[model samples]
Target chain A: MPPRPNQCSQLSGDDYAESGRRAPAVQIDDVVVEKGRVRILDGISFTIPAGSITGLLGPSGSGKTTLMRTIVGVQAVRSGTVNVLGRTAGSAALRSSVGYVTQAPSVYGDLTVRENANYFATVLGRGRAEAERAIADVNLTHEADRLVGRMSGGQRSRASLACALLAKPELLVLDEPTVGQDPVLRRELWSQFRALADAGTTVLVSSHVMDEAARCDRLLLVRDGALLAEGTPAALCAAARTNDFEDVFLRLIDAADQKAAA
Target chain B: MLLVVPSSLLTLVYSMFHNQPGRFDHIGLTLLAVFPFLTMFLITSVSMLRERTSGTLERLFTLPIGKLDLIVGYATAFSGAAILQAGIAGLVAYQLLGLDTAGSPALVVIIALSTAILGVACGLLCSAFARTEFQAVQFLPVVVLPQLLLCGLFVPIDGMATWLGHVADVLPLTHAVSALDAVGSSSDPTAAMWQDLGIVLAFAVGALAAGAATLRRRAA
Candidate 1:
């Protein structure tokens, strides 16, 4: 079935500044999320600028994935709202424009690399030509017909990214997109990310690797579901009086822990 | 896939050959005689199993797709495949086996579809109760085996205890088998077949509703 037009609306870069709203590509207002009895997110609010890269950095169990899920509209918000491309997250209209690649490879193991892309495109209403292009974007054009199960972890990750880019989304959300990648492939993937951003796509990437954070135009430091800080990597390092993004992150995490204890 | 088709056909042909002689030869039963239980335990349960195995269920819940749409899409995909298998088997039976069946081919197709739908529903519901695929597969005999004894496949309905018969009467497959037999064997459409259709529809609709609720609640 053709993906509903509303689902793809977020993919289009148009209407971003219509009626003087500034019209963020992604916006979360007073958001709260709970899993069972544990509060996962608390009153989080932020906006991702169109055509830029935003990095979310946190340690494990810091609620980074939960926050990402909330933005995609998969988890129900306990309170507050999440909007993607100006429409509510999970809204039928926003799903099409939002491409999400989870931390794990989400491709079908039984299907070939290209078949996985084909299935996602079919659901996303992307044409065959677009799918082929997405295949080329990830440098998987030659391995397109190979079974996903046979592909290496890095190749599978690339295949997953290819699937995410199949519809040419306006907002791309990737959780640890470069986790298993080698150095050369990692550089190539980062370049692909830059190209997407240059083309007016808002990319939100989550990573524990501090150097990756340096690559983003903006950074949101999250620890235990609260925002530690948000700013450009250089500004954040300067504010923390640290030489590197990793040192800045450690300093902020330590400070938050000390403050909580006191 | 082919197993589901040929197995169903074999049951019918065996029944005709046995010809034990009764108003109902009580021979070749529809796939529902076996499918609802197996499907409830196999295909229907696979969506959840896949999600859990891949850790995608939780990830998927984080996406924008609704719980209803997710289940519906999965079921639709499996049902489409099941229908294809049924069609091929039916075609082979018509041309090769030369079985003199009655009623519209569409009706037979509906019979197969309803069986698949019920199978998917049962599989999904059973999956909700299982923590692993092994546990899910274990549900097969417990849930499906009863149909053989209770659906009058091996023993005549008359031979069953009154209480057992009463319980069987309510099962969707009990009616499905009756309806398919009516059409496949050239018997007149009986009130029993209509009753079975209603019951099967109820099973499909009820499973979908309850299954979605269960999946969503756990997904969070």
Candidate 2:
């Protein structure tokens, strides 16, 4: 994938003002999610601007996946609302406009990667050419005809990601998409995401790795089912008095712990 | 996949029951009573279980498809396969093995088709309750064995205990078995046979709806 500069940081004040006239791609207000009497997401709210890569950074079991599911409209929310692409999240109308990839590889094991893409395109009422384009976008064209079950783990996940990209969605929500990828493949994917965001697709990606957060145009630091902070990476570093995201995360966690105790 | 099963089953039956009196009708009854239905059931249940365990089912729910699309798609595909299976199985029993029936042999194939659809529906419903493929296989005994034993194939429901007879009256496969028996014994499709056929189809529809109801879009 060709390298694309992070669009969120490159925008001038007036250029951002021009895009701000329109609504954000995603808007969440006081969203609370509970599963089996345990609160998974406490009252949390955030908005993702169009044409930006927004990273959702948090440790395991910190509710990042749950938040992504809520935005994609598969998880039941106990209270509050998640709005996506100007419609209620998970609405039928939003179905064609939003693409979501779960943490695991969800495509058929028996079908080849290209067949899975074609199948999802049919499901999304999209054409075959677009599915092929998605395959090329993920750099899976060489492995397109191989059965996903026979492919490597990273290849299988990329096949699933290609299926999600079939819709060419306005909003994309991915849950830990690079969890097991090699460094080179991970860099390629990030650049692909950046290219998409530069072309005005809102990308929401969740990851526990702090290094990945530096690649995002905006970062939402989450811990223990609550939003700790939302700002640019530079701004967050300034506040935490550290350039390293790992240290910034530790400092933020300590501050939040102290605030909760007080 | 469709043609291979019936020929092998025919060979097995022919090898075992050579020159028996009324062998033709007995094999005909067996064709209608069990074969297509069981095969379809296993096929649907295992495939659906794979879908669930592999996370593809949950992923599909997030896509643009409706619940009916998934349910009906499975039903139609499996039912279509079962119809082909029924044809091959029926052709072997009636033409090659000389299995005889009083009613039009076409009616026997039709009844088998309907019963196989019921199998598909029940399989679909069972998969919703099963979390693993092993658990899905286990449901076969709970859901099908009771019906097979009490459906009046080996011993008539009338000969069984009063409560057992009443339970047979409620099981869908009972009607399917009785309808096949009616076609085997009488030249015309009897009123009781029509009623039994109707009951079998209604139960298939109900089971399919139950399967759909059990599937939730916002699954936790």
Candidate 3:
């Protein structure tokens, strides 16, 4: 039960854990989030390595959003801890360094995209120029003048992302950032995630889309408020004896179901 | 709300009793008694509910922003609106409709601002308990109605049931009405008027503190 980033179920046991690698961006140990009568995250444990794109993939309502919130330090934990950036999760110190994009568009609906980003930028002690750059980074420059409420679902979410990115956080937690986007935009978002990771920003994104799983450097396969598996895409597919992510996902679900039954 | 409520009270109600010797004075006092306390509370609570539902509060909390930061931010924004509203209401009553008060109209406007702040604080606190806008609106009855009913605008506390009189003494709106009444009939506010102002402001501060205490990291 000690904090082990590399010992998760079906881990690829890859060389990413070698010497001189940075410490984990996040370490969640037996984190249990109970809201009223229902347990939203049941003893979910995992580690996300620094500067890597880790996808948290699962079906809808499988606690992906809850787990992401847990890392962002907003979701109250019943029993266990989530340590991010070497301090307690949600610590005031982490605020400047961690970027969070909620599943809902958290920006003001009445404000233009630029104004929305500028508000967050000002919160972080930055300015409008930074907001413009963040907007451009999310490829929302064309829609920067549009009111967030009037924008399409995809644009609104991107505006949310642009605002989060204004902090230039070392760790980015996004919940389904590409959910309503077209295929081309989705591809662009994946590459943007890739680029952010390459620049040493640890990216943790949650999505139900399995194809998106293939683009992550690592994947935390979650279901039923618990982690079913965590490993590289190839390792996950190989362990299930199938190359297709959807097939392996169903296989893992069945295996977990059997384990629960036993 | 600030302009329309007082303007209508001046035009419609004062018109009906314009022939009465002292009716304009009662109208002026009555407008200051309950208008700000009611509308500001409703508007502030509903807007706070929007912040909760939109999930922006979570994002704001996650920042290095302290609870006081949010509380004060909301307080200042709504308080600014309240003061502006009071200014307009005061101007419309004194300059346009000739709803006369013995005290400086400035003092009346100040009392309205105090009651408006109390409303905002109450709204902020109630919004913490509400999950939806409808629930927030429902609180108007539970939170605002008792104060309105017992504030003695309809009947003096001396004529009310003994327990109801005690309850009115404890309500913030009662203090607001008493303060505005002192301003209505006298050029120099009585000692009791100062005490009433203190009570209204103290209640506003207490409610805001309670609201700040209710803010939590739990998912809304």
Candidate 4:
């Protein structure tokens, strides 16, 4: 059985030295990433607290994906530092500790869902029980024996998610995971993310949808390769003087544009 | 099927065109050099490119596996097909076609296997430059066709212009064809045959190193 929400924190705290304050799960200090001549992420800095669900909210082409990639240690940066799980991002030591799910489904099409999960689990030094539990966690038990190629688009994405979940990674980076999912499934997945956070996992999920912003414990609002705002959902909404989160987000972007114009 | 069918058809056509009693040796040598090389190159390139375009390669890189492990895994997996292909094509060209060669038949099979493995190495290097399967296929003209035209399977390098002969000397398939020719016409493998084999193996290793250097965790 999985540990309860409160017990999970103590479990993780024992592994690292918690002198007086716990270190953040992720720390980025003025990270700048460039692709060719275009700056994909411009001087971004933020710290993601351990065991929390942090939403990376931004418009399309606003560098949300690039930020996630940097955290996962896959995206090359032109400058700055990205520390994940107390180590440098993309270090060999973090390979098994970090789980990343891309926008597109990333499982082998020729393999059955179970086989895909098992293969990744074994790569991470986990066993079959973990693979099966991960399959069940994603609610893909029914499709376990089916080839990923024959599954529906949503099913395939969930299969990819299951593979990532196999190792119970300390840091999970998901890029637009709920894009095409149905309302009920999205709610369930969001709850799952919450449950994982409660169980001492740091989940950094990126989404363009404003409605999902409320579900995150903390939100990082990004626009034009720069961070526009970072705070709790209620604080941001109150600061923008709007109850509707979408309106608050638009107002922030408008404010940023006007500031730049001035 | 990839090697046997094309080689049998080519041998049949060549024999029909020549209509000579001792022409099977020429047919056998051509089949040994061209069939395995072409098939492995086309198949490996497209399949490996599909892994890139489908995003599997990106996920695989995130795993604990190293880049060299992935490249060698691909090479080893395809080499199984290459082995079977060389064996079948060699048997069909030698026994079924009644091709008579002065050299040891085992030497011809060895050349065919080397050429197939070489094809796999070159395919992997070329796959790094292609984004889609169609782009992988486009490399056929720029990469494989020139080697076919200059490899001395259809025309002797000696009969070509000096510059063209020089160009042929640089291609892996040219060395492969020369080795096949040397083994087909002599009782023992010549020094030139050994040198050409060494050159073909060098090309395979060099391309593999380049492929490893060029592999990216994600498509740019």
Stretch of 10 with least lDDT, candidate 4 chain A: A6-15
Sequence-dependent TM-score of model 2: 0.94
The residue-by-residue lDDT of candidate 3 on B38-156, one tens digit each, is: 88898889888888899888898788788888889888888898887787777877777777777878889888999989999999999989999999999999999888878877788
Look at candidate 3 and tell me the lDDT of residue A89.
90
- Two-chain DockQ for model 4: 0.51
**TM-score (C-alpha) between model 3 and the true structure:** 0.93
lDDT (Cα, tens digit) per residue for candidate 4, span B1-220: 6746765676675568566766657755766777777888898899888777777777777778789888888888787888877777777777777777778888887888888888888888899899888899998889899999999867889999999999999999999888888887899889999999999988988988998888866433
The pairs that clash in candidate 4 are: none
In model 2, which runs have C-alpha deviations exceeding 4 angstroms?
A1-21, B1-3
- Residue A23 of model 1 has an lDDT of 61
DockQ score of candidate 3? 0.58
Worst 10 residues of 1 chain A by lDDT: A5-14
Superior by TM-score: candidate 1 or candidate 2? 2
DockQ per model, Cα:
0.26, 0.74, 0.58, 0.51
TM-scores of the candidates, chain A only? 0.90, 0.92, 0.91, 0.91
lDDT of 4 at A124: 80
Q: Which ten residues in a row have the lowest lDDT in candidate 1 chain B?
A: B20-29
Candidate 4: lDDT over CA atoms? 0.83
Better by DockQ, candidate 4 or 1: 4
Clashes of each: 9, 0, 0, 0
Which has the greatest DockQ? 2
